[model samples]
Target: MIDKERLPQVAYQVMNEVHEEEVDLLNRLENELSDEVLDISKVDELLNTLLEHTKEHFANEERLMQEVFFPAMMMHQGEHIRVINEMKMVVNRWELTRDPELIREYFLGTLIEWLMLHINTMDTITAQFITMHKGGH
Candidate 1:
């Protein structure tokens, strides 16, 4: 499990809120996978929810970047797009195979790693830019 305590402090309320949501979703997925009898349907539902939330979160961040005229907006948005595309591919694989273990591996390995790196780097910079430009946290 990715320790929430290790997550970088963004100090931006909206970004932090979205980060918390992401953390909650990841933790919930991890807990669900720990069950003895894997519930494919429930895991599917959770993945869908996470995907939708991630889309919204990325959109919101992009909007904020535009509002603040953040210099790294394009690069940040590109990363968001790449992550979403990868997630879609994983979802497609899940739909075809319905393999709980595969999905769990993707979540624990690819998704979690990408998310942590993104939050710690891109998000941290974005939050700093917003707070600096917008004035006051």
Candidate 2:
């Protein structure tokens, strides 16, 4: 479970709300993975949901950055692309192997760590930039 209090605040309300939603999805995924029976379908569903949500979240952020003409848009967008590819790889692996332990390690370790770091760094800076430039956007 993610500690909401630990999540860093951003200058944008929408960004913060979207991040909270992401955290909620992650928490739900964690719960699903922790089940004793290991429902492959549930995990698959959650993984898909998370991927879709992430894509949408990135798209929204990218649009906002574009609106503000954010200088680091390319770099931040590159990171988004990289993460999306990584997520797709994990989902494909899950489909092929259905390995609970592997997925658990990924979500609990790599995915979570990357998300936290990205939020603290790229997202924080981007939100600040947007807030500074965005007028009614």
Candidate 3:
């Protein structure tokens, strides 16, 4: 589960909403992984859901950045593209191997670490830029 205290303070309300949804999704994924039966299908479903949500979230953030003429928009969008591609690779590998342990490792290691770092640094900077231009609180 993500620690709320660790989340950056963003002035945009929608950013906070998206962050909350991400936290919920992460918690759900963690719970699903903890099940003793280790349902691969369920894991696949959760991963797909996370991927879809992340895509939408990134798109929305990108749209906001574009609307506000954010100087770092290209860089931010590139990061989003990179992360989504990595997620696709992970999902594809899992589909081929059907290895629950591999999925677990990817989730607990790569995904979580990337998300925390992105949110703490890139997202935080983007949100601040958007807020400044949009006159958001």
Clashes of 3: 0
For candidate 3, lDDT tens digit of each residue in 32-125? Answer: 8889888778888999999999999999999999998989999989999998998899889989988867766777678788878887788888
* Candidate 2 clashing pairs, residues 3+ apart or interchain: none
Indicate the residue-level lDDT of 47 in model 2.
95
What is the C-alpha lDDT profile of model 1 across 34-125, one tens digit per residue?
89988888888899999999999999999999999999999999999988998889989999998877877888788888888888898988
TM-score per candidate, in order?
0.93, 0.96, 0.91
Model 2: residues with Cα > 4 Å off, grouped in runs: 135-137
lDDT of 3: 0.84
For model 1, name the residue pairs that clash: none
Q: Please give the RMSD to the true structure for each candidate, in Å.
A: 1.3, 1.3, 1.5
Worst 10 residues of 3 by lDDT: 1-10
* Top-TM-score candidate index: 2
The regions of model 3 sitting more than 4 angstroms off are none
When 1 and 2 are scored with TM-score, the better candidate is 2
